[model samples]
Target: MASGAEARDRLAQTAMYDRVESALNLVNERKSGLTVPNKWAFEARVGGSVSGAQLAITWSRRNEPEATLYLNNDVEPELAAKTLLDRTYGLIAASFADRIIGRDGARDVSASMLRRVANRLNELYTGRFDEIIHGQSLPLVSIDHLERAGPNPFLYHARTGEVLGDFTGLVRQALDRLIQRNRLRIEDVDVGLLASLFRELFSNTHLHARTDLEGALYRRSARGIVFALRPVDIPHDSFAAGLPVLKEYIESMEREAARPRVEFLEVSVFDSGPGLAARTLRSVVPADLPIEREYELVQKCFLKTYTSVSNPAHGWGLPRVMHALKSSGGFMRLRTGRLSLCKWFPPGMKDPRVTADDLQFMDIGGGSPKRHARVEGAVFTILIPVGLGN
Candidate 1:
């Protein structure tokens, strides 16, 4: 019979193998394509077999207007978009130089516009072809490790207040457009607070996510922020069925605003590097550590008490984010490691309270939390609902 230590070793090896298999399955799934749950369906195809040395990544949207129209409330489509972008980045990192085809079969103007924005921010074909998109535009900010010469307006440094101010100015412009397009009636949003929230997220990515476990920058990486306005019918039963907190929040907003639908501005920040759990642990996590424990570590990072950085001033970023969201009434989704967590804050709440309980495991397609494949780096998506006109 095997000794206790040998048995434990065998278990650990089995777990490691399982994780590897899961990761491979995820990659295969992405290569095949992704189908969003409920109404939306977007497909991605990577690296055609006939392309001798080069690879091509293509994205197609199905179901016409619905597929291209709504994004923030649903988690699957957001994940699918990120996966497509990540795959493109991975192929570029592998030195595959070719055109990435982004075709919108629906041909909605907004869809085409959003695709252009995505292509620009991701630098999908930077410097190779005239078709390649570049330049800093409102609502999309492209952050890169390589510095550009001659006063690039979009280049942002997280610690510098002036750069942050410029970044927030662009954000406010984007938000203003959203309000005008949606015909929303409300007071000016706390852009300063919103800017602070973004600063913290950018700071975290720059400090922790830019380096490897051994503290080396990645040879090839992609990082940026993309903003979009999604119009959602309030009390969207199909989308909110699995998300109890969001359902309740939406219902409350409908009651307060007395409107059946609302528009939301989604701000998504992505980075390519080691994920949150890996950075916090600062070592190779043992297979024996349960996913629950890993999740706990990730959650702790949001608390004011936790700081992976040695400096005392560094840790308040995430907590401040929580505070801002709590005060403004919004939704946040965090994807990193093997976890997807979500939180929703109801609007016009007298009690501006936030606790760890507000953070809960995301219900994927109306199912309980399952073994999720690890996400490359981290993606934070925040949704701020537009107030309804009386």
Candidate 2:
């Protein structure tokens, strides 16, 4: 017979796993609608809601729950906004067809923010706005599409040179803003390399994200490159406990800095399609494959010469991005399918080139890989730290 303490510990663990599994099923299993719990438990569940809400909007069926979001009164507008704003959650929720209902006259701040951003995204997608809206004032050159482009259409209508130049310019501007805000100094060469990194990421989405697993164009999908800036303070203890791999890198940055926190310009490119492993393997990943095998398949994507496409000349993108991050001492987190992996590069590392082995399963504040929920699409978040300015 288990003691009371043991019973409580088991219950806690079960709750954690249940939360993770619920989020996964909400996205992957195609539930009728989303019911967002109160704000306290929302953070753990919102990631799944993002994808699930998008699915609800795009995959609506007759006689189904009206693709609605049922909200509770304990939720705050700002918390809901912030959670939805992370990655593509806000956009997906805004695109939802049915109403977002709040119980007991609770304010639906999420609905308002979603609508605002959805309008902006539509404007940007239709070329009415030259830049995308991150918030009310931050205009970024981004691409967001709620509907499918025609079959085999050009991903970007602009000329390759022009699009690349626009993307590079936006990246440079974003980095400049980060530098000014954080009083950081970055070299011109580094700025250009970072710009290239984003360009390649956007290019990658174009190459791999337009179709379903069977190569048919998706009738409805959410795909885009979005940017946001966040200030993060990873206390020494937390770093040591949860993310020891980044310890050296964080320490090196904080050595002479006045504050321990680092400001990161987050660049996230997400797409609703078959995820990285599925696309790389050109088939659905076997459901029974060990987690280790799944991790290996994701790592294979960063190999120096990996091309899921047919062209022999087009396999260097991911490796180049890896090398650039290693050189710039940046951090990246990739969530796709059942894997959440990350790699950190400290400045002046002995081997500037990243290999597949360097990728590790991300520790989600639990010191283990068990917390990861399967994401329907691929989401890659690249965090480039802004250093203290001279």
Candidate 3:
């Protein structure tokens, strides 16, 4: 009910997590110029988001040990023709002429600060992962950390994956590495389908975002995205807690591996576009719609008719992803805006892609979608058996 800016004084009096909660609500509001003040320093604390691009933008503005971005709109758009970044730049140019004037103003702020302030707001958004994460000092994957890691632990840059020229390059590298390291053969039916599945997800995250402020997707984006797949071993009791289908899938996988512990790769991809709520709000809600509608529309993304585009190929991306996971007995959790969905496939549920009749089979969790700490963009976490290649 209270706005992000309004929560400021209230936040000052509360404890740490309470302040974190307030910050999350501000970012979710989808308005630019949101500020969360405190005795904060630069750090990587997860959970944050924007209006339309749920995965990316949400992570960018995620309330961390540092401050949330305001006056920057590359990730979350608040208007037409210009992002909050462009508009904020214009306002700053007029109000604080000495500090910055239009594009040239970026030079005044540290690249790190500018990134949080205006992620991918400029032409040169791609660079080294070390600087993107820990600045120029520490190696992206610390050699010391590697020594302590288990045999299956993947060494990667958490703040940003391998720095690429663009999000497209990131997608290629992530998928390629997964296949190569796993020794997946092209002839395997699941291999090609797996590639297709991630390809569609990676490409769609880049494509689907349409900010009321900007017309083009790639043209306005400068910073790169990150995707990582790491190994995880689920405990038997926890497996039981998952959807009944997931428990069986894990059981079968362990039986095949013939090991006491089963390893699964946790795949994650993040993008900084306005969240689904903000994008749909542009078309669906003329007046104040229920905040819960954000969650409902996201679930509807699995249906055939719910698409943001007129193209014949637009709506099938997620369904295909689910189908591939089902083929491989995978499980997933998706978080964006006010929605979070978790689905487990036993390979027996009615096909979602072919028929809308089985929509109820989907498993989605519920909570306060507007809690200040949640992300503004989209973040996907999927668990698939590591031995998928064999």
The clash numbers for all candidates, in the given order, read 0, 2, 32
Estimate, for each residue in 95-169, the C-alpha lDDT of model 1 and write its tens digit.
Answer: 211122122322223443345434544453233222221111122323343333311244354345223433576
lDDT of 2 by residue, 137-158 (tens): 2322233344333221122444
RMSD in Å for candidate 2, one decimal?
7.7
TM-score of 2: 0.68
Worst 10 residues of 2 by lDDT: 4-13
Q: What is the C-alpha lDDT of each candidate?
A: 0.48, 0.52, 0.39
Query: All candidates: CA RMSD in angstroms?
Result: 12.4, 7.7, 12.5
**Model 1 TM-score on a 0 to 1 scale:** 0.63
Q: Write out the backbone clash pairs for model 1.
A: none
The deviation in Å at residue 213 for candidate 1 is: 1.0
TM-scores for all candidates?
Answer: 0.63, 0.68, 0.51
- Tens-digit lDDT track for model 3 on 1-390? 553323221122122323444445555554322322221111111111111223223323442323223322223222411332222212111121112212222233434333433332221133333223221111111111112221111222334542222333433444454445444432332345545655555555644432332443422221112233333344363433323444555565554554454445444444445555555554423225554666566667766566665668677767777666776666666656544555655433355344453343333322234322355446554565544434
Q: Which candidate, 2 or 3, has the higher TM-score? A: 2
Off by over 4 Å in 2: 1-22, 25-32, 35-66, 71-87, 96-118, 122-166, 176-180, 185-189, 233-252, 256-261, 355-371
After superposing candidate 1, which stretches have Cα over 4 Å from the reference? 1-24, 28-152, 155-167, 185-188, 237-252, 359-370
Top-lDDT structure, candidate number: 2
User: How well does model 2 score by local distance difference test?
Assistant: 0.52
Given candidate 3, what's the lDDT at residue 49? 14
